[model samples]
Target: MANAYVLVINSGSSSLKFAVIDSQSGDAVLSGLGECFGMSNPTMNWKYAGTKYDVSITGGGDHHKLAIKRLVEIINEYGLAEQVTAVGHRIVHGGEKFTKTIRINEEILAEIIKLSDLAPLHNPAGAKGIEAAIEAFPTLPQFAVFDTAFHQTMPSKAFTCTISNELYKEHGIRRYGFHGTSHYFVSREAAKVIDKPIEESSFISVHLGNGASVCAIKDGQSVDTSMGFTPLAGLMMGTRCGDIDPGIIEFLMKKGWTQEQIFSELNKNSGFLGVSGLTSDARGILEAMEEGHKGATLAFQVFTYRVAKYIASYMVTLDSLDAIIFTGGIGENALPIRREILKYLKIFGYKENEAANADARFGARGIITEDGTPVAMVIPTNEEFVIAQQSAALL
Candidate 1:
């Protein structure tokens, strides 16, 4: 049997992150990024067959069309274009309309664009890329895998806001978690690691990265998650001020802050960067903390504290947590952060195996918990591969 290959594309407002993966084995055959679109120095690069290549776009990166054209050209040059069976796109927001991965059609594309109001920074670019891909490979099977789809299983208690019913009904206002793909993938892997059936598994999947979120998964479905309405609500992220009081926004506006200015502050200047008055990168914060920087220390404390608090709070949602699964940039690589967060979970009987916890980083995956204690494991999230697999499955 031939391996099924999927071209996975995650399109941002100004960038495209793409990979070709063998869904059967979950291995990316080729991967790279196309970024700085609409700029003078627009560029695209990829790593394929143990070789890396860089290409400067001939004209300005005015739009997704040019970058995608070059992408298809390269794929054809490599002869993998024909081998590719389908394409999977990562749509950041599907609103309440799309609850699962579905093959894309004209109606689907239209729906994707309509939901842009809910994900201004993501859905529009995703829709544009989908349009380009349709133009590029008109016959290929393409699918839309939404980040919010997996969380649609969340019960009303977990998804509802205390706002009026009219607002939710009329404006589509309510909690819609992001990173659903990550949470879903990690929870399934956590079940495997614990040697338990996914149907019986319960977990608090913590996807800690620049954009972080904690999700409570039970029986392989998302019961609740940290992110709400937008990606801005969640664990203290690199820049997002997660879970703030509504009054703060109005208060700031009355104090002479514009709506745009307040949003910029909350989404770009808060979190570790705002708290530490330093860079948003966790590595930088850790290094600064080691060097005795007070701001860094404070950032580390607040970051870890909030994460631990979230994990603890999520524990009540699950009848029995099979494990506290950690996966994402900061969750997988930042052992110090994981170790610190686990220390806070010690009260819940999560004992980290110092050696294993320290060893599990940079492509490593394993249980970081001590023997016979409540499990806390680190499993790297593979959202792209999940996208590839889900995209293939719909066929």
Candidate 2:
């Protein structure tokens, strides 16, 4: 019999990323994306094994169904449909109920839907994908690999709030970290980079991108992370305001703005976009800085300073730092940003190796640190692959 394949689906507010891999070997046989989900002219691109294919929708509304339908058609066309044994979903929030990848049934689906308020931008989309996939493959088992699973190891002291226990228990409010799949996979990669066993390695992973977070991983486990309660608390992101004062919202509300208006501004209008007052794109910030834009320069400085400070704090969490790894978009490719952040934390023995940081082509894994300090490396995160591996193991 042909080896079973697992289809990994990651649904975002605006896109759907899918990967199909051999369940026994965890090797991706196909990877693709569906973009502009709710917009006109939605597009689906797929690469199966080695060949590539594309499809377009002239009028787009709900992309979850269309994307899955297109992906299934591609699989069938390649004669790989029957080989798909399982479907793995990259769910953003599993809350406290699911600590690991679990089989998705009606009960599991209901639980995930219950947590929609916690991940408003992600959970509904993920649920849609899950529902669509289950409908397409009625006989196949489905798995939910939560992004919050890896951080479940964080101790109470680190994840708990100073708020009353009654409020916490009553509202289910706590630090349920995201990007766990990325952090989990990258922490393992960092261990390999340092030639040390995962159980002994201590490191901080900075996942800087459109949505950024820093995770302190010790002994291959998450000790603490920057994101708290929501993705809106962390490093400055493309559009989301991270680590802003709570009073700001209160003040804005008192000035006549509603809760939804304040939320829309903070989660969609702020961050690099608000700070720069130009654009949210990191590359655009760099270009503006080069052109002597004061806002961009100040925004970049603030962004890097907060990142450096968090790295220092996370180092304390680890107690003995072995490496400071960078993953995600800006973390992996923005050499200048990485170098600047390292320079700001020079007091913490963090130094940049200009030559190493300048080598942008090393997308897999490589060091960017001076001698004697904890290793600083860029390990490109493959969260979908991690979900696929976890799902394969469960089956």
Candidate 3:
């Protein structure tokens, strides 16, 4: 098994990211992305050793199966297919059935499919990736590493919604946090950086990517999180509206808006894009703000304000905070965003080291607080490594 590899697949709505990691060292032997799936001209971009390649796939552009088959072909071309010992998939939503990493089998496949309704845009595509992996390497063991599993330790008080008992008890409607893999990885890293055992440390992990969420970790367990029931309930995200007035939905319904229209608007048109009427990428918004764009400036203010408020709210749940970690795209980069957030958090005795904050970006890990009470850090997340490690352990 030392010579074998664990292939990790992360299937997104319009992209497929696959990596072949050395099972023993957990280093990526090869990694690539198949992007723009379901589009007319889909492209494949990958890197090996020190070289990079990008090309358009001819016809296999609209399906996960085709994208995966192309990935297997690339692996075979490099003579690395024979070294694959197992396949690990990143499943976004597991409902309540999958509380931890599990081996993929017929029954498990059925359950993953049944859970698709809970995550229409994610689970279905993940299931398809699993099926394709099975077809591509029938002899290899396949595992499902769920994003929701890490936050399953959250107590009921943190997850329970104030809706009808029937809605929650009958249907599984409660806060099921997303980005658990990133949060879990960063929290452990934070504990290590401070030279403390994770099981005895407390952390507030902020994963601020296109999709954002904050988790309150007490003694290394998730006590509460920002995202609820669905990923749309947390902090304002790239395109999704977070924590909005419930009455707005009912009002839109009364105005003759269809459910499909409302759903599309909330999930696809809201958030930074809706607020700015421009783009969802934070880099673009920040650049626009520099150019005196009012909408971009307002969007930036609202986004940081909401994130600061959530971080402050979670502080109440932790008896003693060990550190506050920032990961994901915006969290790792976007120094302006970090500065604005810490400004609102000054009441908590947090003071940012301007030079350190500006220096940390795109995988540079460091502390950004100036000898603060609760340490503030910028640690880039490695979710693929977590998946690979879990898969190898199961094997």
Candidate 4:
């Protein structure tokens, strides 16, 4: 048989990201992003063999379907479509029904759609992408790699909400942490760095990106995580408000704010953007802070402090802390954020290696801490690889 190639699709509310990976070698043969989807000017930007390509699509009604069609056309143009044996989709919320990766079918697609309410901003968009892929490649096998699957190992004490048990039983309201693939990948890599078996290793994997979260892994299993029930409950992210008081919602409602208004504020207008009254990107926030912007300074401090607090609190769950691995965009690239976080975590004997931390940026992976207990390290996450691996295994 020809070498199996898996195409991993991560569809968000406004964009679709894809990578075609060689399953055996775990390398991305091609990757791209379709941005401004569902808008007047839809654009597909891709990289192939270190070369860049950008094309604008005109009059594509549904960008999800159009993006997949264009992607398929590109694959066929390069004569690489024949090598693609399977497709893997990144589903944000799997609820309790799916605890592992599974083959996608009509029934499964329907279930994913049914779970849309749980992840209104993600599931609907993901379902649209899946449908489009299925239509475009009817013969190809596809699988769903869920973000919530990795945290299924969490105990009831860790996942259960403080609300009434009846409400949880009826509504399935509990902590279903996001960013499981990144946390799982980094934790395994961290074990290898320390020359310890993952089955016996304990780690706090911090995934700080536009959408951030922290995970505590004990013996390769998720014990507890920062995000609860939805991606909105985690560490402060680009636009989402993380860990806000419940009373605030009620207070806003009493002030004549509709549920839609409140939801929009929390999910799209809050977090670093809300606090700083500036752009949501961490880089922009940091730049503004350097310019003596008080709001930017406050936002940056809160973001780092919340992350540090979670890392410290997760220590209680680990009997033996092998290392704390930082992955994702902010975690791997932002040196000052890493330093500030470590400064607060001095109790764990973590001392940052200034030069090493400075060098670890833009996908560079290495230990950034001086040789000591609970070493600090940066490991750029490859979630697409994990999706491909899981999809190929299912096939």
Candidate 3 colliding pairs: 175-229
lDDT agreement with native, every candidate = 0.92, 0.87, 0.91, 0.92
What C-alpha lDDT, on a 0 to 100 scale, does residue 230 get in candidate 3? 87
Position 165, candidate 3: lDDT: 74
Clashes of 4: 2
lDDT of 4 at 323: 83
- Model 4 misplacement above 4 A: none
Clashing pairs in 1: 38-61
- Which candidate leads in TM-score? 1
lDDT by residue (1-395, candidate 1, tens digit) is: 66779999999988989999999889999998988887777789999999999987786435688888988988898888777999999999999999999999999999999999999999999999999998999989999999999999999999998899899999899999999999989888888888999999999999999999999998889999999999999789998889888999999999999999999999999998999999899999999999999999999999899999999999889888889888999999998899899899888888889999988899899999889998888899999989999998888
What candidate 3 gets wrong by more than 4 Å, as runs, is 1-3, 60-62
User: Candidate 2 — worst ten consecutive residues by lDDT sum?
Assistant: 356-365
TM-score against native, each model: 0.98, 0.95, 0.97, 0.97
For all candidates, what are the clash counts?
Answer: 1, 0, 1, 2
Candidate 4: worst 10 consecutive residues by lDDT?
A: 367-376
> Candidate 2: misplaced stretches above 4 Å?
1-4, 22-27, 49-52, 58-62, 360-362
Kindly list the per-residue Cα lDDT of model 4 for residues 1-395, writing each as its tens digit: 77789999999888999999998877888999999987788899998889999999666478888888999999998778999999999999999999999999999999999999889989999999899999999999989999999999999999999999998998899999999989988888888888989999999999998999999999999999999988899799999999999999999999999999998999899999999999899999989999999999999999999999999999999898888888999998988899999999987788989998899899898999886545889999999989999899988
How large an RMSD does model 3 have? Answer: 1.5
What tens-digit string does per-residue lDDT give for candidate 3 at 196-310?
A: 9999999999999899999999999899999988899989999999999999999999999999999899999999999999999999999999999999999999999999999
Cα deviation of 388, candidate 3, in Å:
0.3
